[model samples]
Target: IAEQFVNTDLGGQLGDWLDFMKVMTLSSDRKAAQPDLENQRLAVQVMTIHQSKGLQFPIVILPFLQSGSFPSSLKKHPIINRLPSSWMNWEQDTETTFRDIHNREERRVFYVGVTRAERELYLFGPTSRQSMFTKELESENPQPMEIKTMNEHQDNSLSLSERKQRLLADLNREIAAKQIDNARNILDELEKADRGETADGSTPKSTSREMLHLSATKIETYDTCPLKYRLKHIDNVSERKTRATLEFGSIMHAVLEEFHGLKIAEQTEENLKYLLNKNWREDAFEYRLRGEEFRKQGEEILSDYFRFIQENPPNVLKRESPFSYVMDEINVKISGKIDRIDQDGDTLAIVDYKTSKKKEKAETNLQMALYTEAILRDAVPGVKGNPGKANLHFLRHGDDPLSSHQFSEQNLQDSRIKISKVADGIRSGSFEPDKNEFNCRYCDYKD
Candidate 1:
């Protein structure tokens, strides 16, 4: 059956073979392609780590092990660093819960790879590489096999001792050259400074001061990439023109706010559409075709939104109507726009609206949570006998449906704790940029 399979047209098929003999024959073809395996070898299967999770291999060659490689140093930092203390704690707890799930999956893949080897298993990688698995191996086993270059593995390869000597000589030569160049540059710079040449031919005493009000966004940006934050916030680089999505969001926000402000009886689909047209910029639509698409999406969203509001208007008691409110300021120099402030008797509620895609796990966003804390402590006066509740309403992306989360006192306190830590980090200039692969993939600064 194996001989017939190898010679027949059926052997050139894709996918798994169910027949026992066919499976064994196919596996042999894969092994033959591998360098270490010759006769009786099977087909070589190549796949990414993610794809290879369930599969096992006789040999695994993980090349290019470096500081920024596997078990990446980037994973040390958390993604939601600027989260409010309460939310931060909650997120951390949730993260811990999920961490085990991820670790188990990783372990399963590793186990699959290890168990795959039948007769021989070879794990080859760079000698100078630093990976989590590599580190673990080094810790468990004091001695590790030295990695050799292709030339070193050749028939006429140099001895290990000779290779070391050659490498050392090359390093020494490079170091000597670098030292000489540095000494020459320093000497030239000192001579110029002594002769009043102003080093780079610029006045040294012409320093200027620029006020930079650091917000949560700015802090997060600085943490992601200091150079980016400096270029944008410090140097005041002009941002790219707003995209269609953002423009549409702004238009929707404005129209929605206006619609809510109107008398309940006065609300009409035709009037709302008219308001949308009036507010919409002629050039808002980048293209005529996009404009039509935008109109269609807008109409659907507005219709749904109108129906939602009509069905469920603000549920305040008749006596609780016209909730008078005043914005409080925190002396901490932190400033944020409170979207809507409503009062119910002695209690005040801070409401913020977010229009984003619905997340499966919608924990309180740290920034907004911090804002709530600020309002409770700095903005709302406990001494004046008027303390308010904080609520966040996230409107589903491209829809009118809302999901809300209320903040407790504990949540506010947690926000304060996270904020204090962030503030300390900022003051101490310890905000380090984290290069998380997930964030790097989408980050504007990533190159």
Candidate 2:
């Protein structure tokens, strides 16, 4: 109000009037005051409607029930409007008008607030300009009282003893009610404990809750932003619809998996093109023109990759190999899929496909180290040795894209320690967000 007063450039006369009003409000019956329950320190809880969700109170007061205040005017979604009806399954997923969606969400929030009162609910606003919701309720044939005047009291004010007595009576009633609720809650908890059940009425697991297996992808996500990892993994929050780049990567990986499954002689340019066309995502691209551009790029990339492979064919040992490595010392299990493994002389070479524009360094990359360690620990069949080399095969790079790194003992150990720290942090529920502006800009769970 003070800021608004300044912004509105209200003069000294208006300021003096505001000061008088403030004083009048403070002395009024509706003056803000906490309950005087010292022993229990009980007081009326004040919170937003959102915070009151799924919680029932004896009495709930909803203020600012005016139409403009409660159900504010709808905001436009410019991006959604500009998007194609079929792009990213928008129509199929929503199947409703944007205004309707907004109204439904607002209604749900209002319903939650209303239902939070177990016994009594009070709604305050200008009777002349009531909320649209009040009209909706009226349509249901509910009775509403319109008060014009209160019955004249014999005394305008109460004496000190009379006020004290009234306050004491109200306080005692509240205290008794609170005591009964607390006792009931205690009894319920004791009963659940005796039955060997959790507070949620489910049987408790014997194993430690901290025992969790993590994927290389999960560890990398946690390293980048712990909150993102928790929201996606622990809370099972759905990520934003896959962008063209991610969908492209997925489709490319699928095509390569099928292409490499065949013998070297069977892997020809014609066959590669066939596989690419077969596995191409039609709906992944936001625009048809962009899609065509990507398709042309994919064809060229596949052609170049096919030529490179034909010139120097790798001794493919296993393709799309799944492996799991358990570090018993830290009680951390690492699981991931290696894109390809090759028999490079005496030791095995771990190859992970990368579809991104940027190249990842194998030495410092925890994902590469994890795959190498797993293979070295005999996680993959017929492969039991240290990391001869780890290569990040960037599919975006048509010719000579393999970034290889031979990990020393210290590098591997450092990677392991880092992995352990990530595991410990996740187990301890330490999901603090990394507030890096660059990362947060593209983060789906930034909120």
Candidate 3:
């Protein structure tokens, strides 16, 4: 592409346009178009699936026609399964009765996408056993013009000419890679200033790392995949982006904290909304519209929580309180924020807000248990020696909350022991990745 630009009659103009595009991409948070594209003829438009709705196009190119890419994965949630009143009049199919709406919705969305193309619809789906879209495209029962991938070479799927072309391309790529490597080696040799004192210069410092503080998230991350933890904590290679889910969680946390921290008289819906507005991070989402949707969800969740608390309040004690406990015996310390702490007479209750429909297991939740350990270790003012109750307030469930299982002093003690062992392993450079295909979707270290 660059070669074509340089070889063109308007070489200087093309080069300037490319340089301007590069500057725009670097200066902006996302990729941006050239300013002069508006003045140019034969304009092309690019947009997301949601943005393409109700708009017709002469030609449409749908790339990455995979299972999740088309309709996305639908999680099993309590509210999502319950159908609304409008679907009652439709034929009572298996999808309407059982858990098949996920697939049905996927097909419907794809149909809408295809219908938008009046003349041509190009579906570029890769051939994979796991991709349901690709399998259907490969089948005979097809009205859509399925453009078979030109890269198909296995099992005599390609013509002789195509195979020859592919082989030539591969050979050329190999040669180019070798030439680049040789050039780099030559440049490195030329750049070398010192030939060394005797033989092979001074040896580099020994590669050894030190262990730092440990937390529940750290332990859980390490347990999930050691490579993931090392990539995040050690290498600092994160897939950080404007994430809607993470941003929503943070927004809800702030709203809840403000709701509980204020006095009972001041704890109004308006006041809570004010706190949400104050803490609303618009830049944390890829799109401003998505951030608005998250705001709406947060508002509803907060309203439900505020109403529930008014009816069933538990003498709100603390909100968004930071706590740290040192274990010199294990040479480790745990630090975390307690979402909420409730006082029930002499006993105190630990509460954590969960955004997802799924609940964190009590046995594995080192957060509250670790907090309880601090109270047990020393004489806390409000809390008794034993924590009376622990609750997981799942926000997605509306008013419903999942009660935590019974946790004991032994649980807390053993948790510390586990942390100590993990810390020691980390110090000794024990980083073994737990390879599970199930987690590759979420693992940043996989690629």
Candidate 4:
């Protein structure tokens, strides 16, 4: 029985190989081995809403749907709500407006989940639960299982402190409204009090103009969400530092930069290893427990980096030029520490080293595009050069071949326009926190 079952092709060649086990097997054992067998053959799939994209399934059971379940109610409101409408059209069409953007995306995902069922579909829900999808599903299908489970009793009751908080909130709103009324009454009384006073009065006390200092990030923040910016900057709420991949990338970058700064002949394997040991931060282990694994990975990365540098030693002619500048600035005082700036007489090249795994199509990032703009405008004076002429190098992990992108002025400008739009949104206080499951999983601000 084991031999026959093992030899039976489950789906394809891979499936056949997976099923072919040397030991004895049972129905329970096989079920345990392939836990997805129920949904696998039933033409029904039980998947998280995100995984349902770009594929068709006859039936999809979205068991959990609640305020904090599917479309998490924890999403922070957009900064646009605080803006005094001279800046943005808050009353625009629901589909086009920024206010409804997140809701629309959520609805689209819900729609995709619903449409995935080719034939008969079932949407299960609890009592008192309502959503756009819930309404649509009920209207379309008409019949849905209404399951009501007994609510568990809790030992704890509302505390005195909790009651006090509710009372205080009510009192505060009443007090605020009363205060406004009182202020108006005071203004009317002040006119009667000052009936005999001169129009000029005694010269009003001089007041200082509040200084406004703005950075590129500040401007961007302002456009994204004014309220958020106010909360972050004016209120001085410190954003907590969380898990950042930048730290890992920085360590690798520092090592490579050091490697390049050394004399060409001195960049040997032994010397590189010595530099890696000297520069490595022992304290970084506190964030991630995979310190030993990272060390091994770092060693592997160093080996690859060393080989690439040896093969493509900095071109001397390209390096020596007035067009090339390190840590150049773009708009908003935005500057980047360019790894290698190369100039071939009329043409310019910006090379950035990445320690990430290689992708099929190497693309230019916003940071790189900004760097190219800075180089053209700030680094090279009076040179109305073509943006497409510039070179971009992406050095990946392992000794794989470098991926290159030719920077174009048009592309750079287009990138700037998009960045500026984002900046504008932030400046106008329209920035909203996009709720994503992946983000929630890794986010330090999840609470």
* Model 1 CA lDDT for position 58: 59
List residue ranges in candidate 2 displaced over 4 A. 1-209, 285-287, 382-386
Clash pairs for candidate 3: none
* Model 4 ranges off by over 4 Å: 1-244, 287-289, 316-331, 343-346, 357-364, 380-396, 399-401, 436-442
Per-candidate clashes come to 17, 0, 0, 17
Per-residue CA lDDT of model 3 for 1-447, tens digit only, reads: 433333332324434656856765787787544657653324666777778899888888877766556556667566676566466666654435333677777777777777789887777753331235435443444444432333322333123233233333443444556776655544443233121111233312322334268778888788777667766665445443334687689878877887777878898889988898898865555344566788788888888877887788768777776766667765576777778778866777778888876766766677667767655654344444446566778887775656575577788778777787777666765667788778777675575
User: Candidate 2 on 1-447: residue-level lDDT in tens?
Assistant: 333333333232344557755876787766655556764314588888888777788888888776566676687665754665445555357667656677788788889998898888776654434565654664455434432221244232221133233333343444556776655565666566444345688754433555579887888899999878866675455565435687787878888889889887898889999999898865556445557888988887788788778787888888888888788888888888888888888888888888888876777788888888887788976666656789988877876788899877788899888888888787766777899899888887665
| Candidate 2 positional error at 388, Å | 1.5
- Residue-level lDDT of model 4, residues 305-366, one tens digit each, is 67776776654222312343332122233444556665445665666666556543334456
Clashes of 2: 0
- Candidate 1 yields a Cα-based lDDT of 0.51
State the weakest 10-residue window (summed lDDT) of model 2: 154-163
Show model 1 residue runs off by greater than 4 Å: 1-216, 219-228, 238-242, 315-331, 343-346, 358-362, 377-391, 397-400
Q: How close is candidate 2 to the true structure, as a TM-score?
A: 0.53
Query: Judged by TM-score relative to the true structure, which candidate is superior, 1 or 4?
Result: 1
Provide TM-scores for the models: 0.44, 0.53, 0.53, 0.43
Best by lDDT: 2
